[model samples]
Target: MATSSDSMLAISVFPSLTGAESVSDEELAKQSVINYVEAVQTGNIYESVKWVVDTRFSSTDEQLEQYKESLSSNPFSDVSIKSIVPASNDTFTASVELTRKDDGETNKVSYQVIKRTIVGRY
Candidate 1:
């Protein structure tokens, strides 16, 4: 069994804006949030979670399995971003709901404030 700390080390946040101190535009923040959510819904289980999740959330592929297990154990297989708010120029927060196709029960899981370095927008 992996310790909590070990499990936490699995995810590695790639180089991307975290929406904290780096982004403030509601539209952009919201869009990014949308993109992140979309990526997960459309992406493979392993690759999808990496897009919006940080390393501290989980470690190792097995740990990620646990995450999947949690969702699978429930009824939701996909997560949808219901809303987003700009916490600050460097912080963007989103309220997301996880729903399962089988049960149709949506559970809310807050991903805290997503922050990131500023990436130029077209």
Candidate 2:
């Protein structure tokens, strides 16, 4: 959920700090976050990469491989977006949850989450 204080700070911070006065679009941020959690739950590496930030976290091979492995092995049934709220004007946080449903022989997994996203594609 986007908090009032967080929104206030975002509206104030970026112009001076990042140069961009406005914060990322709420819908875009929210979608990015949604895609991220959904991809993770579904173990779709390609989908996961689409919204991933190009930063230090993507550089380490060890962590990357581990994440890949984990995603590959997960038996995801579905992913659901729950809620999104702003933490700051430019920054928002989301809540996510995952579940596994058993169908006699196997279990299907799913994800439920809330906030966060990227620059353009909302």
TM-score of each prediction: 0.52, 0.50
Indicate the residue-level lDDT of 4 in model 2. Answer: 18
* Residue 11, candidate 2: C-alpha displacement in angstroms: 18
Q: Report the number of clashing residue pairs per model.
A: 19, 16
In candidate 1, position 44 carries an lDDT of: 47
Q: Summarize candidate 2's per-residue lDDT along 68-118 as a digit string, tens digits.
A: 876656444654555566655545555444444343233222222222323
Task: Give candidate 2 regions above 4 Å deviation.
Answer: 1-24, 53-60, 101-122
Model 2 is weakest, by summed lDDT over 10 consecutive residues, at: 3-12
Q: Identify the candidate with maximal lDDT.
A: 1
Best by TM-score: 1
Misplaced by over 4 Å in model 1 are: 1-25, 55-58, 75-80, 118-122
In candidate 1 the C-alpha lDDT for residue 49 amounts to 50
